[model samples]
Target: MDLLKFITAGSVDDGKSTLIGRLLYDTDSILDDQLEAIQRANRKNDDGTLDLAILTDGLKAEREQGITIDVAYKYFHTEKRKFIIADTPGHIQYTRNMVTGASNADLAIILIDARKGVVEQTRRHSFLVSLLAIPNILVCINKMDMVDYDKAVFDKIQADYERLTKNMNSTQVDYIPVSALKGDNIAMRSPNTPWYDGKPLLEFLETVEVNQQPEVQQARFPVQWVIRPQTAELPDYRGYAGRVVGGSFAVGDRIVALPSGVASTITRIELASESLTTAESGASVIIHLADDIDISRGDMLVKAGEQPVLSQSFESDICWMDTRPLDVNQTYLLQQHGKTTKVKIQDIVYRIDIETLERTASDGFGLNDIGRIQFKCADPLAFDRYAFNKANGGAILIDTRNNLTVAALMISEPVDH
Candidate 1:
């Protein structure tokens, strides 16, 4: 079975955790002892039933406060497919946590409390789903039981959400009415929602196509290490080792080393002792080139004539993840794949108002603030526009003093200055 990675996000009390727990409970994905432990905790809902949210809100503080703070990851598999679910925090202060979880997800489940309808976190998380370029979105209109499973309520919320996301041309959106507490429309369709004709949440997830479009694919190999052993037994053995982060690499294919701009053809591809003719995305292999070139760590290899934008400055959208405010005067480190270069914040164009989705003038960004900015790298970097190819376009900014990652960046386009 293929794997699907997804994230759940919404406002606090939107039932994100409960929905995940219900899926695990109804699907029998939870262990007997684990089920018994939550039961033993005796955390019950308003109606005196066991609180399923506790299954993911495992932190004592979270259970006591009834809110998720950190990102909680859960894994389970059914006969049809395997899943990795990230239950991210919903509070405004924890928006950075949501960004971290959604970074690698193929799908995003933005839960809307049927009782409350569309709200701030709805827009915030939706904006993030678009900004991160998540391919698929399944908006789970949860707590349908609270609204008596009325079809009107589902339709109203669905319409409002559609209007909010109509501009998201690249993302595919779908909706389902669900009462997570009652195990309806999650693992299976509920009789309560008889008017709904769509497949249940689990079934939809199993069948959804999250594969990347092959037409946009391009090869990107960031050389993490260059191996050279001048032993008498095997002289002049040189190989570049790294994981192929995008597209594929085949032997005899013409390639170029970026930043160096040297061209060569792939002589061989090896995985440990085995030789391979080709290596696809996500494969870690040592590659040999036809000609010895001055390649080093932090250099990238790409297919000839399909080179990424080479520039020392670029525009980007960033989420400030640190407590300290962004300072344009101070120098930071921009780490893109294997390359780490000194970068300075050239300017902060604007800060996004999460609730209204407006770009407002801002002096600086604080924790969890999302905005548009420009970066000046010390050396020319090879990167694609984030919307075009995420594998080679995403990067992170690290604080020079503490070496802590301070921001998540999505490259927009290369800039001249």
Candidate 2:
């Protein structure tokens, strides 16, 4: 079965964790030992039902304070498809954790409390989801039990959400009413909402179409490791091993090593011990080149005719993840997959106010801040705009002092300057 990676996001106490727990419990994905442990905890809701939130609120701080502090990942599968659920923190202070968890999500389930309707955190997360360019979005109107499963409440909230996201950059937006605490409209449609006509959350997830790769099919292989084991058994073996992050590659296809601008043909492709005639995206294979051109780690291989922008300067949308305010003077380590380079922040064009979605001049970014930033790299690098190619356009900035990731970057385009 193919895997579906998704995340749950909303304000505090919006039932993000409980919704995940209900999905797992209803799908019979939880292990026997885990169920036993939950029983031992004896956590239950006011309705005397077992508190399913404990399944995802794993941290001690979370259990004691009754709020999620970090991103919690849960795995489960049904006969139709597998799932990786990221139960991200809903508190405003933990917004960075939510960004980290939602980075790789194929779909985002933004939960709304039936009682509270749409709020600031809801707008904040919707903006982030749009900014991240997640393929699909599902707005789960949760906690229907608290509101007596009223159709009007669901309708009002759905209308508000539609207005909120009317100008947002999203490809697909869907809605479903659910009561995670009572397991209604989660695994299957509930009779409680006789007026509502829609598939349950699990069924929708099983059937949703997810674009697995970017639209562009230009092959990109960033060399992660150069294999040159001079052992007698394989004396002449010189292979470049890495995961194909984009497009496809086949034996005899002409390729070019970027930055160096040297060209060669693919002589062979092997995954582990098996020989392959062609390698597609997400495949980790060893590639043999027809000619040696001093290719090394941090260098990228692409089709000879097609080229990604090679430049030292670029514009990007940056989500500042660190508590320390950004210092434009200090240089950082820009890590793009296997490649790393020294980079400095050149300018802050504007900061995005999550509350109003307005752009304002900013001195620098702080924790949970989203802004447009211009940066210059010490060396020219090969990459595509994030909108065009996700595999090549995403990167992270690391503080050289502590090696802490301070920012997540989404490249817009290479700056001519």
Mind giving the per-residue lDDT tens digits that candidate 2 earns over 1-417? 799999899999898778888998999988999999999999999989899888765564654676535677889999999999887777776777777788889999999999999998898888888878898989999989889889999999999888878758755889999999998899999999998898999999999987744566889999999999999999988999998978899999999998999999999999988899999989999999999789889999999888899999999998898889899999999999788999998999899987777889998889889879999999888998887887789999999989999888889988885
Candidate 1 yields a Cα-based lDDT of 0.89
- For model 1, name the residue pairs that clash: none
What does each candidate score in C-alpha RMSD? 2.4, 2.2
Lowest lDDT 10-residue stretch of candidate 1: 59-68
What stretches of model 1 exceed 4 Å from their correct place? 46-48, 60-70, 167-169, 212-216, 230-235
Q: Tell me the TM-score of each prediction against the true structure.
A: 0.94, 0.94
What would the C-alpha RMSD of candidate 2 be, to one decimal place? 2.2
Query: Could you tell me the lDDT of residue 70 within candidate 2?
Result: 61
Cα lDDT listed for each candidate:
0.89, 0.88
